[model samples]
Target: MQDVPRIIKAASLRHLTLGLAALLVLAITLALPAGPAAADPGDVEAASRGVVRVVIIGEEGDQPVPISHGTGFAVSPTRIVTNAHVVSEATQDDTLRIGIVPPEGKGGAFARVIAISPRNDLALLEIAKGALRLPPLALAGGNGANLGEVAAVGYPMNVDLAQGLDMADIFSAQPPVKSRGFLSGERPSRQFDTILHTAPIARGNSGGPLLDPCGRVIGVNSFSADSSGGDGEFYFAVSLRELLPFLRSNGVEPTTNTLPCRSIDELNAEERQRLEAEQSQARERMAQRSEEMREVRDKARLTAQMQVLAARENRMALALIALIAAIGAGYAASVWRGDAARTTQARLAAAASAAALVIAGLLWITRPGLAEIEDRVAAALAEAEGGPAPEPTSPSTAAEGDLICTLVPDRSRVTAARTDDVALEWSADGCVNGRTQYGLGKGGEWIRVFAAQEDSAVAVNTYDPATRTLRTDRYLLGAEALAEAREARAAYTPPSCGVSDAARTLGEQQSALIAKLPDRPNERLVYSCTAKAAAR
Candidate 1:
C-alpha cells in the first residue's frame, strides 16, 4: 500500500511536469519571431549573364591562338572589368588581342584595354563598337556583413581543362560556373581593401564578380588564400571600397540597389496576405454598411406609417366637424324662415357647409393606400436629405495627360529594375507621348511591347488609367530566343499615334509578339501615377 501511494504521487508529478513543459513550449513558440525570407535562385542566373570570359589571343603564323584567359563582368553595356594581369600581355604586345566571350552566343567580340591598375589588379576593357550589349550588374553601396551568403560567378580555367576544350572551343561563348559560400571577413591589404569569402575560385576567376544574395556586386574576385596551412581555403576579392571609386573616377555609373533583398516567393506571399486582409476589411465594412442601411430603412418605415396614420385621423376629425356644421346650418335656415335678412345669412351658411362636406369626402377618398408605404418611405428618406438621391460613381476612365508616376515599392517586386519616377503623356485613344501608339489589352489596360536587336531583353509595359498605375515587366532571354524576338520586331511596323483603329492594329501586333515571349518575366516594376502638378 505504501508503494502504491508512492507510485501514484510519482505519476502525478510526471503529469504535472509534462503539462508545464507543454506550456513552456507554447510560450517559447509564441515569443520567437519569424526568420528572414530566402533569396531567389533566379538572381544568380540572371546576374551570370553579365559574367564574361576575357581571352588573350596571340598570332601563331596565320592563325590566332589564345595565350591566356580570365573572367570579367560587365559594368556597362560597353565596359568590362578584369584583372590587370589577365590582359598585361595584350597591353604590352600589339600582337596579343583581347577577346570578350559572352555567356551565350556563337562567337566572342574584341575589346581594348581602357584602364589598368596593377596595384589593385583591376583593369577595364571597352567592347568594340556595334558589338552585342550585355546587361550591367548593380553594385552594392554598403559593405557586406561577415558570414553573410555570397556567390562567385566566373569562367574558371579548371572547367575548361576538365572539359578538355580546344583553342576553338576555348574562344567560344559558354556560361560561367557558380560557387556559393559565406563571407568570411574583410581583409584589407596594405595597398587596398579586400573581402574574404569562402566561395571557391580558380585561376581564371581573377576579375569575376563576388555577388550578394540579391545579385549585387560586393567585390571582384582577386585571389585565394594558400591551402598549405592545413586550414580550409578562403578567397579574397577586391571589395567595393576600391571598386566603387575606381569606376566612378572613370565615369562609369552602374545601377545601385539599396533596398533589402527579397525573393519573389516572399513578395508573393506578402501580397497575398495583404489582399486577404483587405478583403476581410471589405467584408467587415459591407456588414457594417448593411446594418446601417437596415436601421435607416426601419426608421423610414416607422416614420412613414406614423405620418400616414396622423393624416387619416385628421381627415376623419375634419369630416365629423363638417357634418356637425351642416346639421347646425340646416337648423339655422329653418329657424330664420320668417325673417328675410336672417334667412339670407342661414342660406349662405348652408352653402358653406356643402363646400366643407365636399372637401371632407375628397379627403376621405384620397388617404394614402397601403401600397404607398415603400414609396413614401423612399420619398421621406430622400426629402430628409433636402434633395433627390444621387447615383453611385466608379473610378475615372478618362485619359491622364502629362502625369508623373512614382514607384510603389511595397506593391512591386524589383530585381534589376530602376526605381525612378516615370513621365507619361496619355491620350484617350491609347496614344503615348504623341508618338507611340499603345494597344488596348484584354485586361482593358494600354500595353506596349518592345524587343530591340542589340539588347537581350523583351519589355512589356502596361498602364491602367482607372487606377492611375503603370507597370513594366522585363523578360531576359538567352541568345537563341532573343534572336527570334528581334526577327519578330523587325517584321512588325508600328503605326503612329492616331485613330483607335491604328491602336487596335498595334495591339494585335503586340499580342503576336507577346505570344513568342517567355511565360513570365524576370523582373516587374509597378508605379502609382498622379498629375504632374500633384507630383511636384
Candidate 2:
C-alpha cells in the first residue's frame, strides 16, 4: 500500500474492518476460506492482461462531460464486459470507445455497446475484430471460487505508467494495475447468484475483473469500499458466474486472457484541490442558513415578550381599579351620620360597591381575553415556527330581527297536541324584507310559516289532524320559495298578528307546540309557525 493521507487511510481501515467482519461471517457459515488464498505473480500478471479501462462520455446540460470511468475485461477477442451504469446514457452509435495500453506502451482497439442490463449494472461491448492478443479470463466453477483467494487486478485510479500515457487513446492497453485483497464474502443470492468478497477497488476501478490465484476470473470489480471518497482502498465486484448468464442470454461467450499490468496513482493534486473547494463552499452556505434561522427565532421571541408584557399591564390595571373602588366605598360609609344622611351615604356606598363588583366581575370574565392575548402571541410564535393554529368557535351575528309567529295550546292542554298543527301567522316590518319567522319542528328544522313582506299579518291554512292536511283560505308558498315570499311580505302588514310582541309570543308558543310532537324515526312534524318583521 502506498503512503496516503491519514484521513483517507483511517476511512480505509474502517471500511476494511466492516467489510472483513461481514465477509468472515458469511465465509464461515458457508464453509468457505476465511481469507483469499495468495496468487502466483505470473498468474496474477496473466489475468491482468484482459483488464481494460472503461471511459464514459456524454452530453450533460449542453456540455460534454465524462460522467463515468471504470475498468472492464475482454470476455472475448471482440467483446468486453463493464458495469451497466458506466455507459447507460450512451446510445449504440454514440461511440462505444475502449482503450488498452500494453505494458510496453502500445495502443489497443475501441468498442461499442452491444447489450446492457441496468438491473445488475452490467454491459457488454463489442471491440473491433482481431484487435488484441490476450484472451478473456477463465471463469471459476460452482461450489464457487474459494474465499480469501488472492484476487489481482488493476483499476483506472491505481498508480501506473499509463497515467502518463494518453489514456484517452490507447489500443493494446497496459495490463490493468494490480491490487491484492482477499475475497471478503459471498455475494447475496438475490442479486449476483455468485459469491463476493472484500477487495479494494476504486472509482476508476469499476468493471475490472476479480481474478483468483490460478488466474481464473471469479468476479468483476464493479464497486468500491470507500463510499465517502475516491480513495482506491476497498472494493466490491460482480461475480463472473453471474456475468455468464447475462452474456449467454445475449449470445456471447467469455474467453480467458492475460493482460499486462500498469500502475496509476490516485487523484492528482488538482482534483484534490477542486474537491476541497466544493466542500468548503457547501459548509459556508449551511452556516449562513443556520444563522438566518437563528435571527428569525430571535424576532419571534421578542414579539412574544412584548405581548406578555401588555397582558401583565392590563391585569395590573384591573386590580388597581378594584382596589380604589373598595377604598372609596369604605370612606363614604364611615363619614356619614343621621337617618337621611346615613341612608344617602349607605346608598352611595352600596352603588360604589356594586359598580366595583361589576367592574371586577367584568375583569374576571375578560381574564380569558388576557389568556387569549397570550394565546395569540403563542400562535404567532407557532406560525413563525411553521405550526398550525387552534380552531376557534363561530362568531355571532347582531342583525335585528322580529318573530313571525306564536302558537298557543287550547285552554285545556298545556302540552300542545302531538298531532295538531297550530295556525301560522306573519307580520312584516315596513322594510323591504323585515319579517320574523319561527319553525315548529322539534329539532329546529324549520317548517316555513310566512313570507317576508310589508304586510302586518297573514294566517296560514288550518292544519287538520285527521287528514294530515292543511286547509288554507290563502295560498302559502313552498319552502323553497319561502325566502322570496318573506321579502315580499316585509312590505305588507296583516291586521291580527302584525305586532313584534304578538309575533314573538306566537313564536314561543309554536316552539312549545313543536316540542310536544311525538318522537318517530325520520318523521318531521310541524306544530306551529309565525313570521314577524325585522326590528327598526
Candidate 3:
C-alpha cells in the first residue's frame, strides 16, 4: 500500500515535467507572432486588402442594363483602380457605383469615379466618406515581379453567392467558383505591353489585380482565352507598375491615403460646360475632312471619260474624205473614155487623168483615217458595254483565210468548219486567184495539180466543212476568198492607164491595203496587167 502512494507521486512528477515542456513550446509559438502563420510566403495581407468589385449600370436602348461588372482594387484609402471598359457604359448622368468588400466582417462599400483613361482602359474611383476603411495594395516595382508567379483574385462568377449571406445558397444554388493558374511569360514589348498567363479569366474578372506571391499588385486581369482553338485556358493582365505613372499624370496620387469628402454637386458649372464644347468641336472637324476626300475621287473619274471621246472624233473625219474621193475618180474615168476626137481625146484624157490623180491622192490620204475611225468606234462601243476592246490584228497575225478553188475531178479540197486550225494557200505573192502548187484538203491531205502559171492559185477548206457532209477534194471559197480576189484583180491594172484622178484613187487604195497586212519574211511585188492584155 505504501508503494502505491510512492508510484502516484512519481507519476505526478512526470505529468508536471510534460506540462512544463508543453508550456515552453506554447510560449515560443506565441512569441513568434501571428503574421507568419496567417500570410503566404512572399505575401502580405496589406497588398491584397484593397482589391474590390466594380459594377456598372447604364441605359442601353430603352432599358437599364447591367452594362459591366469587373474587379478593381484600392490604391489609396479613397481611390480605387479598375479597367475603363468596366465603367464606360455609365455616363455623367448615369449612376457609376463600385462595391468594395474586405476580408472578415468588413462589409462592402461604394465609390464614384474621379477620372478615367480610355486609351489604356483604366479608371480611378473615389470612395465615399464613411465607407469601409480598407487597406491599400502596393504596385510592384519596375523589375516587375518575375513572370511565372502571379495570382489573380476577383469575385468571379460566385459574386452572386457573395452578395447574399447563405451558406446553403452558395452550395445548393450556386457553383463553387475558385480557379488558380501560374504566369507563363513576360509580355512582349509595349505593342502588347503587359500580359500575364493564368487560368482563363471570366467576364467578371477584368480589372482584377493579378497578385504576386507576396500579394503585391503585379498586373490587372484584362482579356481571357481567345476562341481560336489554341491553348484556350490562357489569360492576360496589364501590369500595375506600368499603370501607376498614367494614374499619377491624371492627378490621382498612388499612395494609400484618403481625401476629405466632396460630392459631385460641389463642382462648378463653368468647367463642365467647357468640356462639352471641346468634344463638339472635335467631332465637327472629322466630318469636314471626310467630305473633302469624297469630292476628290469624283473629279478623277470625269477626266478619263473625256480623253476617250476626243480620240474617236478624229478617226471619223478621215474615212468620210476617202469615200468622196473614190466617187470623183470613177466619174473622171468615164468622161475620158467618151471623148473620141484624136487630138482632143488625148487632151481630155490627160485632163481627166489629172482630175483622177487629185481624187486618188485625196483617197489615199483619207483611207487610213476611215479604218482608224471604224476601229475607234468599235472600241468605244465595247468600253460603254463594259466589254474588252478587240485588239487590231496585223495581217501576219490574221487567222488563216478560207480556201477557195476549183478542185479537178479526182482532186481534194480542205475545209475548216471552225476558223482556228485550218490553213489557206494562194499564190506565193498573196494574190487569191494566182496558181497554187498544192491545197490543204478537208481530211488533212495536200492535193497537187498542174497550173497555167506558178502564181495561179486555188483555195480549199481544211478541216470540217459541215457535220454530216465532208467536202473532201471539193473546192469552195467563201467571203475570205472573194475579198482577196477583188483586191488582187484591182492590183493587176497599171495605175497610169485610167484618168489621173482614177490612178490616184487606186494608188491610195493599194497603200491602204498594204498597211492592213502584217509584215512577212518575204517581200512581194504588186501585180500588173497591160492595157493590151485587157483589150485582147
Candidate 4:
C-alpha cells in the first residue's frame, strides 16, 4: 500500500521506454549492409556487357577526328539506345558519323540514327548490317525501376579519369566502368519519366544504363543535379516507362529477364542445389520402377515353375500306372502255358511289357529342369529394363573398329544428291562407312570428332531457338572458310541437285573431297534400319 505512488510513477515512464525501443529498432535497420556493397558482382558484369562507348567520328578538314563522345547500350541485335544530345550532330548532319565501340572487342561499325525524340532526349541508332552483334540489354518488367540498390555501368571521363591514356585508349577494347549507388527517388511528372539516384557519372557517362540489383535496365543515365563539384548531389535517369514505348515505336523488342540476379558464387551454389534435387528425384523414380518390375517378374516366374512341376507330376503318375500294368502282364505270361494258343498269348504279354519300359525311360530323359526356367526369367527381366542396347546422342554419331566420329548433316554436306531424293538419317543400332565408324551416344554438341586423327580439328554447332538459326564453327580445318563465315554464313542449306546447272557447279566444290574417301558397302547414311528391309 505504501508503494502505490511509486508504482504509478513507474507507469508514467512506460511510454518513454517504448519510445526508446522504437529508436533502437531504427538504429539496427540503418546499420544493415547498404547499396553496392550488398549487390551481386555477377549481375553487374552481365549488365556491363551490353554497354558501349559511342564515338562521334567527324571530319576535321581532310583528316578524320573523334568528335564528342558518350555511352550507349544495345537494345536489339542491330539497334542501340543513347541520349539524343549525344548523337545530335549526326542526326543534324549526315556527314558526322556514329561509331560504336563494344566493351570487349576492338573493331566497331558505323551506325545511322533510325529514330529520335528530341522532346524525350532519347535516340535510337542502327548499326550497319553484318556488324558485331552485342548482347542486348532488356528493360525491367511492368513494375519498372523503383528505389533500391542500383549500378551505373558505362565509360566515364575520357582521358582525365584513366591516367596516361590517349584518345586511342578510350576507343579501344575496354570494359565499361561500374559505380554502385542507391536509387532513392523519382520525379513524378517530368518530361520522359525520370529516376533520381546517387550513382556517379560524368560527361562521357550520359546514355549509360542504370540497372537494378537484379541487373535489369530500369533507367538510362540522362543528367545529374547541378553539383558544382558537390559530393552529395543527386543524378537522374530516363525510366523504363518512356524507354519501353520509345523502343517499341521504333520497331525494336529488347530481351527481358524478371529473375532476381545473384552473385556468381551464389548462382553456382543454387545451380548445384537444383542439380542435386533433380538427381535425387530421378533416383527415387528409378528405384520405384525397379521394385515394380521385380514383383511382376517374380509372379510370372513362380507361375511358370508351378506349371512345370504339375507337368512332371502328371508324367510320373502315367509312368507308374504303366509299370503296374506291365508287371501284371509279365507275371501272367510267366504263369500261363497250357496249349499252343496259350503260348502265343504269353509272347504278346512280354512284348507289351518291353514297350511300356521304353516309354517310361523316355519320359524321365525329357523332364523340365529348374536351370532353364531361371535363364528365361532373367532374359524377360532384362527386356523390361530398356533392353540391352545403349541410346545414341545425336541423329549422326558412330564408332567403327578403328575410328569414331559424330557427323551433322547440313544440306550443304550433300552435293549431286538432293535432299528429297536421298535420306540422311542415322540408324538406331549404328553404322559404319569407309574408315570411319558412325556411332550415336548421349552427351555433347560436337558435330565432327576425329578420335584417331593427328589434327585436333573439331566442329561445334550451336542453335538458337528464338531465331531458329544454326551456327557452325570448325576449328583448324575450316580456317579457309572463316573469312566467308565472318562475312555471312550461319545457315547452310544446299541448292536442289535436281539435274540443274547450279547443282553441277556445287557438286564440283564437294566432289574433290568426296572422291578421296575409300568406298565400302553399306557406306551410305542410315537413319533407321528395319528388320524387313534388312531381310531384303
Candidate No. with top TM-score:
1
Instruction: Tell me how far the alpha carbon of residue 488 in candidate 2 is from the true structure, in angstroms, after superposition.
Output: 99
Full-model lDDT for every candidate: 0.77, 0.50, 0.45, 0.58
Please, what's the RMSD in Å of model 1?
15.0
lDDT for 317 in candidate 4 is: 79
Model 2 lDDT per residue over 1-536, tens place: 12223212221211233345454454464675354335655556545556666655444466433334566776665578877766654554353333443333355555678898867768888876666443455665433444556564655543533466432333334446777766655655445543445555554666677776656677766654443433224456676556878899999855432321111111124336756897899899889867876676677557766766676668668966886896788667656634574888777886787788677667655553435545665565566656876575321111122322232222111100123433332222211123434333343222334422422122332332221223222222222233344554454443332454543344444543233322211111223322233311
Highest lDDT: which candidate?
1
Error of 3 at 427 (Å): 99
How many clashes in each structure?
A: 0, 91, 34, 13
RMSD of each: 15.0, 35.4, 38.6, 17.3
Q: TM-score of model 3 relative to the true fold?
A: 0.34
- Cα lDDT tens digits, model 3, 1-536, are 23423322221101012234334433543464332111132133324445665655444465533333566777766678887666655534444344444433435556777787766667787777976654456555443433334567665644553586432221121211334555555554333356545444665576777765445566777665433432234566766545777678767665421111111122224336655777788778767755654454344334434444454444445445544554564455566666564556556555655665565565445434324544555554455446885677543224223443222212111111111222233322222223322233233332222111212122221222221111222111122433464465455443332233432344443443333332320111111111222324
For candidate 4, write residues 1-536 as lDDT tens digits: 34423422321101112244334433543565553435555556655766888877767688666666778998876788998877876777777788898876467888888998867778899999998676566676643434468888887764334576655465676778889887765664345687767787776777899887656788888776554432245677888878888998888877664433444444346648867998999999999998989896997699768877877777777777777777887787786655566998888888887777777766666667667577667767777776866765534333112222222231122111112222122222222222212222123221222211322122333322222223333232222232333222222233332323432343343333323322311011212222233324
The positional error of residue 316 in candidate 4, measured at the CA in angstroms, is 3.4
Residue 259 lDDT (model 3): 18
- Residue-wise C-alpha lDDT for candidate 1, range 1-536, written one tens digit per residue: 23423322221101012234334433543465533333445777788888998888777689887766788999898899887777877788797789999999776799999999878878899999987678888887688854568889997767777999755676878899999877766767667898877688887788899998878899999877555534456678898888888888888887777777766666678879988998999999999977876777789899878887788788788777877777777677677767877877877877876777787677778877766778888876666556686675433336457988888888676666678898898777777888888887776668998886655578899988877888888887776777888888888888887754986788878887888886657777788888888778
Q: Which ten residues in a row have the lowest lDDT in candidate 1?
A: 8-17
Off by over 4 Å in 1: 1-39, 323-354, 379-401, 426-431, 434-446, 453-455, 489-512
User: Which 10 residues in a row give candidate 4 its minimum summed lDDT?
Assistant: 410-419
